[model samples]
Target: MPKRLIAGNWKMNGLKAAVSEAETVAKSLSEQSADCDVLICPPATLIAVFEEKLTGTAVQYGGQDCHTNESGAHTGDISAEMLADLGCAFGIVGHSERRTDHGETNDEVKAKAYALTRANVLPIICIGETQSERESGNTLKVLTEQVENSVPTDLDGTKMVVAYEPVWAIGTGLVPELSDIEEAHNHIRATLTNMGIANADEIRLLYGGSVKPGNAGEILTVSNVNGALVGGASLKAADFLGIIRA
Candidate 1:
């Protein structure tokens, strides 16, 4: 069975107060996490603290993004190997914010995924369309290309997870309708099947953007949505645990 995972991407958010929230979230879902994998991908600076506070707890911690290189004078770059060294079991790549703001190219994202795969870390590769693309009724077209371009050709489904986070919805507190989400996820699943992965069904496909506890149960119950890649709500432990519990 595919694991029900609620992975929080506390993107570019958090600070000293985040520790208390992280602790509370770990405590809140410690018991129920056995039913699902709960991960918090805090900024690089907070991974160690989250790991320390979540020790022996159900919540695992990771990083938002990592460089393909292991190490060197890549000023302000954290590598997958380093994230793993910090006890991160997962790494997120190709998030829209990175693609837009930092100008990360598809090849760069693919290289990053390969680097994570080599480092024994699972890469959560993100793929989605923009508001313009969706409005143009080319959602699937965009998705197929993004999936083809962003994912490493060498990666099997188990080597990474994928998030369908429409750029239009991220942080806007808006989500695609359940039908839209299901359609997108199903398309992604089919793409994986064509790749010849044995446990294609078990490879996780997460929905991101405006996911909250109040709406998690229904979303989690969707046919091919094995989990969520949460945003703003991820900042607070209570809010995050609510989604896990939901």
Candidate 2:
């Protein structure tokens, strides 16, 4: 099995003061090694500061998003190359918020993911069904379409992480049953294998959405659930550490 990755997505939150939270996580990990890999994705503005503070520590940092272009006339957008230059080890694409707010399509997400691979940064591609889709019994269909359209086939030896973040559950303090999570993850794995990824089994599938320490251990234990894409709970050192410890 591949090493599990517990990644925190700080989203549009975080300020200079939030550096202390990351520092504490780094310090704790240094003192006591974690069983899984630890990563924190702060907003783009804080990546450099995290790189400086988290260097030589077990914790890794990354960007929340990146542009499909390396460098361009597109204003207010940061490219994958620029994120790699700032020491980002990974970048997230196709997150629900991005899809809803920025009107990002699967093709655009595929382009962005490919750009990250070219920049030598791993891409964490987000895919999930909304509540209506799930209630309508279209969860697996939605995942299949997203996987086929958003993920690029030419990875060029770069391994991309896929995060399953159910849109309705995000920040709603609601979580799916263990059986539901298992089913979704299994379907995702099978889909990847059918897509001809040579290392499909080795690829990590993360479950995101209202993942707190209270449920981290149980959720992580589910088959095919290799890790988590934590949100609000990751904002505090103690809460985040508790999930890590789980």
Candidate 3:
């Protein structure tokens, strides 16, 4: 089995003062051994600061998003190369928020993933269904299409991570049943295999959406749940550490 990865996504949250929370996490992890990989994706503004503070720690830092181009005239967009230069080891693309807010398409997400791979940064591609989609029983179909179009065809399984974040659950304090999560992850694994990814099973599948210390242990233990893509709970040292210790 691959080493589980617990990642924190501090989306649009965190300021200079927030660095201390991450530092606290790093200090705690350094005091003991962690059985899984730990990653924190703060706002782009904090990436450099985090790199400086977390240099010798076990926790890795990354960007919340990146553009497809290496260098371009695009305003307000950060490129993968720039993120790599800033010491980012990973990049997240196709997050539901991005898709919903910026109207990002799967092709655009795939381009971003390819760009990340070129810069030697792993991409954590997000995919999932909304409340209505799940209610309509189109969860698997939605996942299939997202995986088929959002991921790069030539990308290696081990070089990327896939996070399943149901739109309805993110920050809503809602969670799918453990069996549902297992089914979704299994379907994603099979989709990758069917897409001809030779090492499909090596890909780490993460579960996102209101993951907290109280429920993390049960969620993390579900089959096919390699780790978590934590949200609000990740902003606090004690809360994030609780999930990690789970």
Pull out the clashing pairs in model 2: none
Query: For candidate 3, what is the TM-score?
Result: 0.99
lDDT of 1 by residue, 80-198 (tens): 99998888989999999999999998889999988888899999999889999999999999998888778765666666898999999998888889999999999988887776666
Candidate 1 local Cα displacement, residue 122, angstroms:
0.7
lDDT of 3 at 230: 97
Order the candidates by TM-score, highest first.
3, 2, 1
TM-scores across all candidates? 0.95, 0.98, 0.99
Clashes of each: 0, 0, 0
TM-score between candidate 2 and the true structure? 0.98
What value does the lDDT take at residue 225 in candidate 1? 92
lDDT of 3 by residue, 68-184 (tens): 888979999999999999889899999999999999999999999999999999999999999999999999999999999998768779999999999999999999999999999
Best by lDDT: 3
What is candidate 2's lDDT per residue for 153-230, written digit by digit as tens? 656323889999999999999999999999999999898878887677777899999999999999999999999999
Index of the highest-TM-score prediction: 3
TM-score, predicted candidate 1 vs. hidden true structure: 0.95
